[model samples]
Target: MTQPNDGPPQGGFGAPQDPPPGGFGAPTPPPADPLGKQPPAASPIPPPPGGYGSPPTPPPPGGYGAPQAAPPGQPPQNPAYGYPQAPPPGQPPTQPGYGFPQGQQPPTQPGYGFPQAPPPGGPGMAPQQGYGYPTAPMQPQYPGPQQGGGKKFTTQMQIIVAAAVAVVLIVGGGIFYASSGSDEKGKQGEASSAGTGGEAKGGEGAGLDGGTEKAPADTKSKVGFQLPHPKVTDTTTVHGSWVTDKAYVKTGVYEIVGYDLAKGTKLWSVPLTGQLCAASRHMSKDYKTAIAFQDGKPSAEDKYPSCTQIGALDLATGKLMWSKSVTSAASGDEPIRFGEVTLSGTTVAAGGTSGGAAFNLANGAELWKPKADANNCYDMGYGGGDALAVVRKCGTYDNRQLTIQALNPSTGAPLSSYDMPPGVEYASIVSTKPLVVAADVGDTAGDGSSISDFFSIDAATGKLIVRISADADKYAGDCGSTEVEQCGSLAVGNNKLYVPTEEHDGGGEFGDTNEIVAFDLTTGKLVGGRADAGDDYTLTPLRMDGSNVIAYKQPPYDKGGQVVSIDGSTFEETVLMVNPDDEAIRDAETSFSFDYAEFIYEKGRLFISEKMVSEPRDPSNSLDDKQYLVVSFTTV
Candidate 1:
């Protein structure tokens, strides 16, 4: 089973409660303020409605102490505290009123069947210990002294199964897919795995009852339901497993409970702490060390409101190795995310609210503080073993422009940085080896119909390598907007770039149609990709050990983005999340998992979130979503 993929969001859903008449796709804007600024030190601003970001004021003893029994006849609920739920995939509400697939559902009816916090068992609800996502825990045993390029790490290659493609005539036209078996029935069981009712103490097959029970000594405490979606509370590379349950280290107040990817067993829970704003964790190229981001309150200075730091965690014991704070005045609310942290040779770099910084990977010390004009920018793509590639936004209001930059990982040196050519924006750096590919994102039409425009970047010097476009803008379903050319998705592998295009339309107004165009990295020519597979195909290239494995979301269903992949000549898209039960899925023939966790593709396998569930008879029964599954992938 899986758990809700994201920790509860701050600010309580922060969107208009009502759905649009046009059917979904509501645009949620970036915060009025950018992220990552030094907090005001003099006097303090009154805390916001939600208890987030406010500097912690000492409460009288026992104020928010442990939970106690409610007085007699009390409802036993805390109305003052209601944590927010995670907005669905792509966190789309932020891009509201724009390019969206018809029939695609919006955030569930605000309080969708689960309580915000009172009944307990929320995804990040650890005991007193906390859990956070993206960054791995501060485990010890990480390496040391990363002042210069001391070493370079590389992984072995991996291989995966090949996918079988077939064509199906749907409403608009014919489409082809690699219908590998991704269990549709089990998807139902996925959502139903947690938070259906108030019954947290019940055993397996425990019907949704409001009664709360304690857990067995040998087993975990009685399981309480959490939000149906699996939250990515905290991720740390464990001993051979790479990623293990947060519970392995410290416990927290409330935690996300879900299945184990390797054994399919239920872990007690994953924790979420208020300290961490956002995070990212990954192993070194050589697999000898690990690096991560920690968006937390400053550990050194109380005068500093909150800070973002880089930390190294031991792969074996889950102990802290070292950590260094990233000081910047860009903004006060910078968001750190998955894939935001990268390790190059011996140096580590992380993107901030507007720019990126390089750090000593082993010691968490600052190697170089490189700056650029990226407004509210946070993720990055790397190329040329020694350089870091980034995109940043500059200026303010309407005059604002976003630009991409490349910096030498060592010596905190500048290599090349410039404004992305117009007509092309929000580009994603796809690869660095055979070639460096970057994607630009823009929106067209009244809504955001986006596309991915590919560019060849010089690997060593970070220059404009080349512009490779198969005229995707000419495609009929291109949505006619410049954004389509700017924001489409592209995957690079085997010296080829797989650029998915919006070919045909189906269902409501727009469709989830995805087409891939492969480009030869060396020749900059159109190399054949899944050209035969129509728009319905969704693909991502991954590296296992060393080989390339292409992962795809299975078809023959609606909505759920379940995955199946082909490693190479061998194929297998049929393998999907196993069913926990039918109640998890609501009425869809092909079972579906809740859209919560973020996806990270690496080493020939994919890692996705898993969740767990329940349904209650009592009106006020369910806990906010909990876990039933944890998203994890692999290749043969």
Candidate 2:
């Protein structure tokens, strides 16, 4: 169930309000000219037949609009007001009529009275047949005066006859124009109605049959489908769950496998060989390529490695595009670690222990590497735009200072550099334009509570603009121990930031209620108020899609879960779709003590993968005989 924000009641789907007066289908007013401009001044001539001046008086006996009995031997006069006497009892009913004589059909051709087809290729040529009424006898034509000085005087009868003809044309054209406009408006109305049929109702999912009926069968069947898993040998284990729109799993000690999202179909797999340490994978936006970090082999007995390797793979074919080995100056026992891999325009970057490296995404050619300086310039990868961000630790562990730098993605040239305020440790880059940097600022209020602050810096000069404390009352709360990993638990959206809040006191369990607090990305100010996750459910902000936040609702162990949409502006909640209940899914959480299911949203669908326990479980590993079930819930 979803809750609608309190507001004024809206109109129901009963009878639609009538169109505004004088609009479509209203009594035909004086029609405009053929060019759709205003009508000209009233014509001096009398109106045409059935027009305003000639107000359709009852027809005389035996005339067009009146019925008449036939004489002793002749057939009854044709009922001119309706269909033409049913085509003399045997013939076809001559072009089905609607209260009009078949011969007097509505104007199909352009010209006046009882329209007839135009001549084959010529414009406006009169047809062979005239109006259905009797044709006047041909009259003699008189020659006009010769070009001499003698002027020819116009006759009064001639002027009157000409004016009458003009009136007929004007009135007839007016009627046609009005009728055409009416018909067009009717068609437009029908199209508008059909187009809005799938529009979402108040607080309900669109395309869900007015939000009353369940989603279609095809959508429901997408849930609980199996996803392809890599074969685990003695040296392999699942490294990551989702990479872009596909899944990546470790197939060998140094090999990774990629699978399609919908069906567990294997797409490609690649193996890494001869590296210093374990390899880590990163994917591109299109999922067509991936970058991995390969540590260099250390010298005999020397703990620090002098070289590091970066490898790129073509995900479509599982072939290595290229690999580059770079010189490293690290000389300590601590192993080098890698950060995020990001793609910016035509450049691909990977950040790691020594520093960061930029390479051409298409050819994997090394574009630039960090300089060998005491600053230890380590690349943090590219952010929102073409700006690449890096961090350098300046002081020792007790009083460390992080210097943040913004560089051009294409050339790795430094754009701006500034050291963060004292005592603030750089966590991760949240965005680029404002250079939002998340930092862990010491513990707050004892009780093992650590405070994380988000700083918005000017990207052009690296000047501190605003600082938003994530644990302050304005934000959600203190980032719990587990949530404060690489960066304070926060998700960045366009112009907004979402921070998770623990509704329960301790924040260690799955079923506890959790809410999300939003903040303005530029101003570091709270957006709206706190968005609660209902009574007993946990609401985890998964991702932001346009103006809506996609969140998941996890009910208690045995109950079902639902995917919900929250309006980013209003914080109104709408349940998009519900996931089916599986005892195995619940038991995996309660009994085997597995983490909650994982889900990814791509396009308009949510893909969820949950571990399912098999009947015969291995004692050594809980996941030994277990398989993962993949399911999808669409907007419908």
Candidate 3:
């Protein structure tokens, strides 16, 4: 999910520029050989059939003629081809020859028939020395060109040609090996980039952000380890949420941090150029990229009070991929706020006071913007998958009417629009397939108090299916209060709606008990009899763990909290581990407003974080001392 940047093209070796006009002007001549005469036009004798020097042949038989018998008192007579015999007493050894000498051995010299010294300073003549023999006197010069000299020159040339061929082969092999290695590295990079869709396909080492070490598998229980509280300052508010099944992300005013869920280790942290006003709301399927909105500096003249921008970042590396302004002319004194940042298929979208706009996920280039007439739309929220839900405000504030519209998430084109009943206002979206909406229709007593109603409508046709009244339904008593906003969070799973009842006063400092109510999505009827969790606990539905509904208790800071698992069909409750009775843990929980403590569920694991008071409270505090304690529990 790397967003393309508009810059110079990346990666490639420049093609060898066509050898300048006339091909490097003509190749230079080869250097002259310094050790011998130039080679002949052609070799006089053909190479041996076996190539190069032929294998050696057998030596003459009878040992080159039987050894001659020696005289009575003398050493055995030296025969031809025998080891050279030292001259009688004090004389030098005889020079060796290929065949027997005519009468007596030739004068002792360095070589048998070759010159023993360099020739006089002539034009092209020089003394010759046999291979491995030392220099000595010159030999008699021949009348014409020496036949042996030509053969020697030819032999040297053959050796030179073989050496040149070997050099070329070595250089060519090195280049080929280097190119093959580069190709393999490129293929691996491409494969990793392709897996950034909905499913990440490799083990821990697969998606490392930069060169960070891979985290070990998450096997330790919740009680085995605890993460230290994150650091924050008084001026900045810290928010935490899950970005992927194995990673959780935290955002502050100017920084975003990521952590490994299994080990609770900090993976990476990125600082932003502007103040981050919104936490990450949209993440690419592969969890490689995330979208966040930032509030830019206000205009100098204060004509345009608020400036906003949307940006994308690499999840693994914390690299800022791209950012662009998504602002329009202001119509009121209040600053603009972006309600939703989401991903629809391959498109990234952001909705604000001026309607919504969609951008290409690969480049961050705006693809489409909402129509001018749709400027009245606000409070945009994503409806599950690809449906963009918004509220269209019409008329004055006191006599205003709100209309709910489902738009194409990518194009911002309206698919269905329904005007809410006279006294009703949209509260939240419970489902997307059939478009279930929870609306707060005015109080039953007509005193402007709250009375909630659930509406399930067809998304394609805007046809109403069922309207369940909160006060009249059989399970109405299960809802602690008539106000829809105070009924806790709503979760839909296994074709049923799970809702947490508000904490009720039982003559205690804090509410003692609350129950979780389940209703069939299609029939609008209770799934089972009321199931009370117990005293001193409030259960809020978080997510589904296999076939069971997972919820957690939000106990008072002094009392500890625990995670619960309820059977989706039977509504039976099972208490997981309760928080340790540690004073530090209780103080951390009480440090922040109860709302700041967040519990997130993903891939059968529950993540919880509590803000920590690192230093003593001071109203004029300037030091950045805010922090949070994080931990995880396995639900499956």
Candidate 4:
């Protein structure tokens, strides 16, 4: 998942793990603090009240933009910006915020559902035994010294799926999505159309519309503005962000706030009934997206409410557009809580452990509701945007069958379905148009990135094109284990898949670097073009800009980060926006984990934001570390 340092190995849904050493995007300590001095320690501040709508809570000492220090006698807790800080010796490891469980380490080889300790071998060593899955041996395109014996691994992950189902049944009949057919009757709500929610207040600025500001002839950028992190007592989640030509929109505690794109001044806010729980990564051409939130505010007894409300947000103009939810027959007609939401054309789709449902984007009308049947099949999740696709699970838990389907967005009908190979407990859709899917078949992707192979399929024919074996330890690409479309560090465009090689030794002393390589989707062969990240830097493909690949470069400890546009055919990079190397600005810029952070770059401006926030690691040694919600830079 593109960690910046050699931190703990990520396991399960808890804190993400670090990959093996010296590969693309490997974690290494940053250069010495640019401030050239330690921050003075301060007394801890009491946490704010519990529940939603609480005022912004400050973070622990030594936080970005604040005075930094560890308590006296406690070893310095300073860590590279954005990477999770490990607690001092003997103290419990730091816990990630937002409902992620603590203390579970990633399995040695890939295993779905439950996590077990790595089999006896040390890091980079292959697991001694397979967890009842078959193995397929293969070769790498650019072979190098890496973990495993160059043999691609897959596991019988269905066994763990069975375990999950049994646990759900035992735990008070929890939400277990098994659909044989469409049986649930959707409860129609009053039609709420786009822009129904009132417009947000605008700041004293002009050009409030879509499109980017003009770029400077010289691409070097300076600090545009920064938004302070909202003070949060608990580990709160601020999960969504978007940019319209006119404003920068972000999800706050119980509201969505829009700010002046270049000035960072508040322009508008759409307050919600509860905290935002899920957001779509893709935005429509009209700057519309989908989101999910709790129905009610959190109380003392029920601190975290179910994410049941689904809504479409208009980014150009601050509006809720429409908010609604559906009932699941499997859940006794209760509102089906969703874990993810996405937008495809005019369709808004939501899915979770209970099942999945779709709605009209213009008006919150039910398009379809999941149904129960003999086969016990359900739509696990979907990948949206250019096209609509779904990862459907069917059959018994012990012999669960996963299929990737290209669907008709308007009718929610499958246009084509490609059956996944066995032993894949979970699958993620990397792209819907090309219908590329990734899975840790046999749990062989030991790096915990949940990717071992990329299945390039013919969406129209529902036939396999090629299986690109991307050993997790060698490539930096990662896809969410459960979420259908959450993938990063790679991009698919121009009939090719572009992924970065693991970080390795660079030419200069004390320098490490990597490159982005392309693979032909049809033939599954290396395209022989590589875009190198110069010494002490790592390049990750962010997205496709026409035929060009826009990438972000995580710089060395002493340098500022950079955004570059690489020509697809030539593999040549053109500097788009280069952040300043000033000490203060550098710290602020680098304080984002490549994997977990949200990066938006357009028209010579780059914005970095966090998806999660929490209190200080050592609450007792709290300092007024100036934390920020977002840091922006521009070359205009």
Candidate 5:
């Protein structure tokens, strides 16, 4: 299905971007076979419910062999688009960590949807429906023609059918669903959280003054690791706040901040980054010895944000263990960015904005770097271990072609690669079972709006394990587009794959009715009918705890968002509060919308960020003010 020659494109979740509007700049392969190549995916992810037309296209093995051990030369540096320079040597590198979840916050109802949110209670603003693209000015007069195909509905047209509808609890522009959990878990298996951090004053995020600047999620979400409350204007690694007692670290911003549930102080504010720095500029996760996320991206250049230095500092003292740069020779003058610099055991696996590299985090030494076709490789996220998933141009949907690389996270040795889905600029989402989830658009005819078929690739060996399709027509009716915008977040947790879709015809950028659906990892069958999020819903895939999956969604039509809990067995729903004052907030009938949606079930909470969308720019007001929503829910 690699009609890479397909039409228009669309497509980031976080960290970096591919070649800009024009042609993709040439890329450099890792020196010394930098990242070792990986086994190719043997199969393709099955098309979603409404199966798509084509299958995935497995890209060839790593184009370039690991680069030869470079001569003792200085690491390459990036030319700045515009930013401060790094400190001289003997100085710490920059820190990178925009850990905050992106999403708009709540405000007094002015008849407008969520607006510039303050810390707790910001200023009052007029509420009016914001800018949105409406396809059908008035609902199409003719009834949808009866049609049937194997493809699951992209999002069936307004069916004349109805579920148990009710006066959904609406308060403070938040929609409250009759959230209920399994009898076994009681209310424990409920929705999201901000993180392992203290709460900010409600009005702390008043800096932005426009509407919500929301973009679809990047493919870097964890299997329930809720992010922190992030801001809209966050340029550098805008790492948002975590839940109470949870700790998160950053490299460029080079600071690890989180709340110590036991102590309650600003847990540990280790000074990882020095003065001038950028976010996600440089950093790596040290999940082996201590539960710390480290950074060294302050020294990252604009182009290569992910290209960074490394230092296993004393979690307590922030003292350096051994500082070394994760450098690569320049193939072309193109700069690079990075996904979360992952540290498995002590090895570091990072996807340079342009490509990716793996190094021995223990000695600050380079292990291996994988080479890519010039301008072929783009940003990729890790699925733990020696596996890295990436994307690029393909069939339709900007040809969101995702390729999974099972490399030696330490030596960058070639393990295997996955068969890539045929599409453009797609992302490889984080997976728990050495699997890679991707957005694959099949033969989309009418418009490039809806996604035909979304795929899930096996990371171990590039192969198609399952295909979640929304490709063809249905007896109910035809769906809207072949884009994944229908689903807010796509992730896997608690042995279940979670996908949330939004159908906002005239609501806003990603506005529409929200639906959160879960699928069995082994089998592509859905857990239950997608949980309804009302007219519009935003979804966040959360981490998993015992037998349950944590997730959250935002309700459209002036409805605040709420967290949800799904019973692995029963697929029940429970609403939790990411923001504190849960009982009080619920009493006040507060709701929310998240920019970055994901749950950190490992820590029992959900995280979200609020940012202002600029591209599909708002007509009336420019979404300036952005706030974050962080909450946690537990099994009853």
Candidate 6:
């Protein structure tokens, strides 16, 4: 089903562009390869004036990197972001916690989906001394269509359907679903304190903290280990991560490697003939998963071979159980190359332009294969988890139609299907069970975020539950333009959707702030409570910890990032781990761009890894650039 060859657009996909018309934070492009060789993503946002790496105006007490005792009688210098500073004389020192007291009224703030007067430096001014990059609207860079045969499809459209199968794998991969017997054993302590040396809070079951990893008596965390970026002549996809009680596994060049979970010691490696192209975000209950890879090693003449091989992998042992490809009359009976693969129950489902198919996870038994159709329909991709769902395409290229269906995990049969509204070219399945789908209806979001409305559907009945209109400029969530299951920075739980508000002016003169707010699934209206990120920190929903929401707070340049558990009912935050303010540690922790990186926080461990890796931008200083593949921190 090779579509006709349409011309590639100028600048190619992911090329950097001017900031969006208004200075709202734009959807960050996926990480580009080193330098400007591959399609370059927007520049690493400029650091705030006098931000990290700046000439210290007063030179934080002990300089940077490590903390030192304060001079006799002088106030503490560069207090870690969450801990409190000394209060004014006579005003009893406030508790040394990162957030306000429970039920305390939050101060009036701006940037809640509405406009307000710009801060001192005007809109989009980078924060001062913040730990992470602040987001603002940048011009959206939509990939142009690539025509083949007689059909035309946007590059991102192909990517949407093509990469859909990996959604569940990414979401469920080792972080959330990987089997860990020790998780339960670790969930015995109360929330950790804010300061590195402080005592733990004295409350039991205070909030539904995420994962079973018990917080340390002191909440401060130190670097566990950091893996350096592998040298690559060109951009390479290394987008897989998994965690187990004993090991932390990730994809590498032409192989998969497993390392000791707590210690970064290499344990095992599974070799492959070609590089990995896609990986399922979900892991099987038995510590198994699926992946797609090229058939042969790349060469100068044929750099990227067809991603025709699908295989099952045993994460515990780094074993690839099986590998094979499928064929359909749609491609004149030749082996069909797949773009994405996912696992649901005991079945492995993969989709591409040739159509879709499923196989038995345990034995590699073909349960179904693609078939040629008159309408030129094809299975674009699938979202697999609590259930299996597909985004099926139909009709001619000019008037394409799309249907989303919840499928029978074993048979590939549609149990229910919902037709997308007219003119909608692509849709992302945010969650399979609740049937939440996101789309940029009428292409109105205009921020390259690839989302405008979130449709909540009844998977059992294929009926719409509610349509939530998400104003792109005001919210921070990304259902990538190219994948149905590649949405991030948002979480769904407790029959509600949690999303971050775009960064806006904090009443303070030097920094910005944001909050995580929930929307009721049934009513599509704003929920009353919000978890504020405090000043100079950006909050994002990571996942659900039963009824609580696990979130990450991007730190201001001088401080370290934080992970917290927000009570779903009260929206109160419990500090889980506050990274040390050691300058070197802060830099390493924030190096991975949140936009294209994968963060798995389980059992007091925060693993930040890149989905793509590239050679150093300055080859001459390749040895000094110090690029990183994975940077891990833990509180245990």
Best by lDDT: 6
Give per-residue CA lDDT, model 2, range 485-529, as digits (tens).
122234444455666553331122122344666766454445545
Q: Could you tell me the lDDT of residue 237 within candidate 6?
A: 78
Candidate 3, run of 10 with poorest lDDT: 171-180
Model 5, span 489-593: residue lDDT tens: 443444455554322121222333334555544444455444545433444444343444445554333433455555545656655433333343332222222
* Residue 102 Cα positional deviation in candidate 2, in Å, after optimal superposition: 74
Across 1-636, the per-residue lDDT of candidate 1 in tens digits comes to: 111111111110010111111221222332232111111222111111111111111111221112334568875433211122246888634211112211333433112111123225656653221110011111111111111111001000000000000001000001111110112211211111111000000011112221122112232111112222223333221101234422222111122233443434555433332222222223454332333322332234431222244555443444446665553443333432222345556776654322456667666667765333234333233332323555554543334454555555677454555556543333444443333434323211111222223455544444544444322122211111211111113333444444433223222222223333444444444443343222232333222212223333433222233333332222222232221213333122122231212243322233443211223123254643323233333331
Candidate 2: worst-modelled 10 consecutive residues by lDDT: 193-202
Model 1 clashes, total count:
153
lDDT for each of the candidates? Answer: 0.30, 0.40, 0.41, 0.61, 0.32, 0.61
TM-score of each: 0.45, 0.53, 0.54, 0.69, 0.48, 0.70
**What digit string (tens of lDDT, one per residue) describes model 6 on residues 140-219?**
33322211000112224434432333331121110000111112211221212110000000111122434454457989
Q: Relative to the unseen true structure, what is the Cα RMSD of model 6?
A: 14.4
Could you give candidate 4's per-residue lDDT for residues 225-334 as a string of tens digits? 99877777666567788888899899888899999988999998999987777788777788999998877776766554667789999888899998987876665657
The worst-scoring run of ten residues by lDDT in candidate 1 lies at: 157-166
lDDT at 94 for candidate 3?
A: 51
Cα miss at 10, model 4 (Å)? Answer: 24
Q: What's the residue-level lDDT of 226 in candidate 6?
A: 89
Separate clash counts for every candidate: 153, 2, 11, 33, 201, 30
Candidate 6 ranges with C-alpha deviation above 4 Å: 1-214, 619-625
Clash count, candidate 6: 30
